[model samples]
Target: MWRSGSDAGAIAIGVVVEVPTPGTAVKHPEALGADLWRTDEPDLDEPRTGIRLQEIRLTSQEGFLPRVVVKADLALSSASIITMPNGTVFPLDATQANAMERLWGLTTSQSLPALPGASEGQRKLMSHYRRERSNTLRLKKLAEVRARHGKCVCALCGIDDSSKYPRQLSERIFEVHHLLPLATAATPVRTTLDDLVVLCASCHRAVHATSAVEDNYAVLAGHLRGES
Candidate 1:
């Protein structure tokens, strides 16, 4: 939904990107990493739009609909289209009553953070929600690695967990690392198996601790081999 004033050519001051399930509460909108775009000419038939503004990140005030917050005061152009996460797009005419229907429909998935002032049980539930989401992806990546390599080994340190530890504990030693850090992404990106690498717990921690390590894994590998 978008907001406009009573003017012949009312500029859309802001647009709301609703949660997948309307009225679903989101405690941490920042964690979503959602981006909003304003387009002058939007192809209603296609997901593509002529972008008028740089993507702006969305933030909320612990409430129903998250609001758009931009560094500079940016307003949607007349007859503009707003592009939101999960492939949601809205075509808006400044002169007409703003009517929007979900075009180019796609499955919307939401991952919310723990609510504020929640009971211990509620906190645990949210914790599990996050863990399960993360583990699902991690386990899939690990499975693919094991399928091709026959064992889970660290890409950096070259530690074969199966050989060093018991079968049950061995799987816990390896972790999935993103070559491109999700936190640094400007927009939501589709992460494929190629974007992930397997790393031992120690090497994973070391890669995160050192700056510029992801680009040059050989540096960390050298350190692990006592060459650095």
Candidate 2:
């Protein structure tokens, strides 16, 4: 559920806006536009849906617990349905996670992309794991992504979809603001993916307006390290 219109002013780093299939991701002919609706196409480009898993195989809690989860930004993608060890599947793609830690919690207890607090060396180490895959994640892993981003989602206006405040969030028009900027030499070396934010245009604008800066950098250095 994606939307349009970038917050033209007073923006901060990109949202961390958790939308619930607010709008359609608009269709086009070139590149991803043509295949926007097809998942597992190996290259749909309709925003490669990312999920946040609780645990590929963990947990004894009740309610939608199947050791796997997937949270894609798209409102109605197929990645939401998860298959469990018992052949029991739960459809929760539109679901949101408790927090970034909750998302990462789903990851194997192994090294992954660095958290916002990771050290410089650790950032580099995690970068090795920070991959941009298409048509690969399962139910559990999808849930993990949602949980992580849900933690740092930028505060929205009038109403905020705070973690646990809602169940699932569709991939709204959250922008990709690079804190360690994909380009430029002045970027921080220790910047982690968490350092970057996928914010709604309005939230991003509010951050800048609140801070009174000109650059698009999500200088969220001072923002809360957890959910807003």
Best by the lDDT measure = 1
Runs in model 1 deviating more than 4 A are 1-134, 211-218, 225-227
Per-residue lDDT tens digits of candidate 2, residues 3-63?
1122111111122223332123422122232233445544333233222222221223212
In candidate 2, which residue ranges exceed 4 Å CA deviation?
1-145, 148-152, 155-170, 186-192, 205-228
C-alpha RMSD for every candidate: 16.4, 21.3
Clashes of 2: 41
Model 1 compared with the native: what TM-score? 0.42
1-228: candidate 1 lDDT, tens digit per residue? 333222111122233443233112443333332322233433323222122221221222211122232111134322233233323344545332222111111123354676787544211111111111244567788998888888887887788877778888987789898888776666546566788899998888888786676655767878878998
Give the 10-residue window scoring lowest on summed lDDT in candidate 2.
7-16
* TM-score per candidate, chains pooled: 0.42, 0.22
